[model samples]
Target: MSKGKAHAALTIAGSDSGGGAGIQADLKTFSALGVFGTSAITAITAQNTQDVTAVEPISNEVVAAQIKAVLDDIRIHAVKIGMLGSPALIETVAQSLKDFDGPVVLDPVMLSKSGVALLPNDAVEALVSILVPRATVLTPNLPEAAKILGEDEARGDDAVLAQGHKILDLGAKAVVMKGGHAEGETCRDWLVTPEGATHLDAPRIETRNTHGTGCTLSSAIAAELAKGADLEAALTRAHGWLHGAIQAADQIDIGHGHGPVHHFHEVWT
Candidate 1:
């Protein structure tokens, strides 16, 4: 057996009480991908497949403490960041991660799939000013990207790609725009870096089990990074893994509404 610490990936997000998304999903993704998972929860949500009924942001002190505690003990090889509920908490997380040196996948989650707002209205500026600059890769869906770019909606590929480059100008090492919300038969994504942009396309899987897909994809990227995969390889592996998970989503019966993807599809298949 391998000795010493296992390949570690840290997820700084919220706790989904329903056990299908947020921290729960992130941890599952890390484990399924063969990486040890750690978490520092920023909020607690009483949510399930249907909706997020409640969200209680954790104290800033405790949030910082959790990050510190994990970093102090384990050598974090990669970091996956999700939902910071407020501007103060966003700053707190940014401050806590200031000393941590690793590839970070920042999932700028704005709202739950059920259309409940997660990030506060006022925290957008703080998130843009602080965390985006530090993020190794900022992953944002269409709505999130539109909000970040101060647009009512980001329309076509040209507009979406333009806004993506604009966000990258804010200082993230890279920007990945998720095209799930884009209108088309095929799902599209563009990875924008200083060098240029790479287009990635796949047939969008139609299923209600897309819950926590964003979290799973980002965490899988972190896991791949923990295993020392380069950016391209990491993203490719993560996308493939997530697609497989979605393809196998209906294998389990979890809840009444949207369900979760099979995180260990690779292992079982």
Candidate 2:
């Protein structure tokens, strides 16, 4: 490593006591992609693989302090954000990242893997107004898109594209709508930008080890961005990484309900 080389990526998110999602997953993804990972925890959750029992959000001032400390000391090349518990936390993060010029990957994390709601209902507006505009790429699942647009309609490629446009209209440079939760053999993800939309299709891996897929994908994208790939290229590489992670998931067992993906699949090779 060079003396002044920038090799760090920051994750602003919540803590998962289960170690399957949020900051835990983000840091694991970063390390798997060979980047130093830093974190600013927004909230703490008492969760297991099956459910989230409790949540306690950290103070806004502490969140701001963590961001400032990391930014001032480390050379952060990219950022991946997830699970802002409340409107106040969202606004605090927005203020902290107002001048950061790195690649920002925003994962619109609304619910836990166990179907527990992680974000507050009123925080959606604050996230759109404060953080969406500053994101280099925003990753949202179908349900999150529905919540953002305030619609109860079923999501397809066309509907997701329209919602992506709505997200872009809100000020994101690009939008990635993940179709894993959709019904199909193929999990199709769309990356919509000002130029046009590019579709990424991959066969959905049928497994119970999908607890942190969203967090892993976004963090992998940020790691690729830190390595100097373009937006589309980063997304493509992230897709590949996530596919491997899922395929190798069966090699280990962590929790009884839904386990985490294998982040060290290539380490022994």
Candidate 3:
């Protein structure tokens, strides 16, 4: 057994039966980063790399109970939230985390890679009003950021930075505007905080196996935070780690369509 301060993180998210994204990816990332993972599943997604066929959210009471159970027992150093399927779920999660002071990495997973809306229209308001305020770090892709702000997708650096500041205005302590959806040779993720912005850029590795990139990145940051890294350090570590995972994605084959990043890429070899 490993001897040291045990790092644990709680993930409040959906479950993907295909083992590519959602809770599976969150847990995989936590384990890979040497953090113990706990979970409160908000929804169950019958999803594969190709599509999300069906989604069923757990009862709000059950979701709350799961979070309570974990917090009542374990020492969760950080929390990563993803895929809350409804307004009520978002409110519940926000209430559940109200007392905890640990870092909260909120990945606003609005749409699937195939363009299916994971979060509905009504719930967006609730997420903004309730959960966004509590987030220590809000991770949103280009389209997700646009949807959150009810604006057109940011096109240039100036537009993206303007939107990032707008999102910070919504009460998030920080925002990571992912550049994956943008047309670019280099994916440049902007880490915008109250102080300023930092550019996290990496060469775009061409690969179809990017099923859980967002989930993995956010969870990995939470994992790093659980290990006591500061906000910028955590984001930097997660970004670098995800780049490696995506680069090594072709080492394994999973689905017929977009496969998952290699969460254990460093260890599997």
Candidate 4:
């Protein structure tokens, strides 16, 4: 068995009262991948499988304090960011992460599982300006990509790639535009960078347990990066891991609406 001080991954996001997405999902993904997890919650979400009824934004000072409390003491190898609930929080987190010289996986979580907007319209500009440029990798679904690109380009793979390139122009080092919501038998996730583009296509597993998919994917990517994988390798591994997670979740039932993925599907002794 491995024995040493556990390397850490910090997740800066929101609290999911349902324990399926946001900070909860991030922590679960980190733990399942054998990384010690820490968090700086930016919001408190009254959310479940069906909807998010309310969101209470955490104070920016407190969010910065949480980030400092972790980074000051622990040797955090990677960081995953999700769900900045407001423009102030976005600016706060972007500033905090600017000094964190580590692999940072950013999941642009703009909406809830039940199609509720988690981020306000005003915060989009802050996120684009402050956070996107510093990200080691940015993960955004088709709709979120559309929102960021200021158009609905979620219809075709080529259009999605075009939008991904547009996002790259915004300054992210790498962009992984997810194709889960796209109409197809296979789910294709595209990874684009200045070097070129790589495609990860997997057979779509029909299952309801996809609540925390974006969080899980970004956390898993951070996990792989913490374990010393490069951007392409990390994205590939995270894609397969999440595919397995979804497949393993097929037999389980967590809620009447979308359920949580099986993040620990590969656990063994």
Is candidate 1 or 3 superior in TM-score?
3
Q: Candidate 3, residue 202: CA error in Å?
A: 0.5
TM-score of 1: 0.96
Q: Lowest-scoring 10 consecutive residues by lDDT in candidate 2? A: 151-160
Q: In candidate 1, where is summed lDDT lowest over 10 consecutive residues?
A: 1-10
- Misplaced by over 4 Å in model 2 are 1-6
| TM-score (C-alpha, index-matched) for candidate 4 | 0.96
Give lDDT tens digits, candidate 4, residues 1-269: 28778778999999999888999999999888878899999999998887789899899999999999999999999999999978888888988876889998989999899988888899889899989998988999998998887897577777888888999999999999999999879899999999888899999888888999999999999988987789899888889989988998765677788998888888832
lDDT per residue (tens digit) for residues 15-99 in model 3: 9998989999999999999999999999988989899899898999999999999999999999999998888888899889888
Tens digit of per-residue lDDT, candidate 2, span 45-138: 9987888899998999999999999999998999999989888888889889988999999999998888898887899999988899999999
What is the Cα-based lDDT of residue 182 in candidate 3?
A: 89
TM-score each candidate. 0.96, 0.96, 0.98, 0.96
Residue 71 accuracy (lDDT) in model 1: 98
Worst 10 residues of 4 by lDDT: 248-257
Best candidate (score: lDDT): 3
Worst 10 residues of 3 by lDDT: 1-10
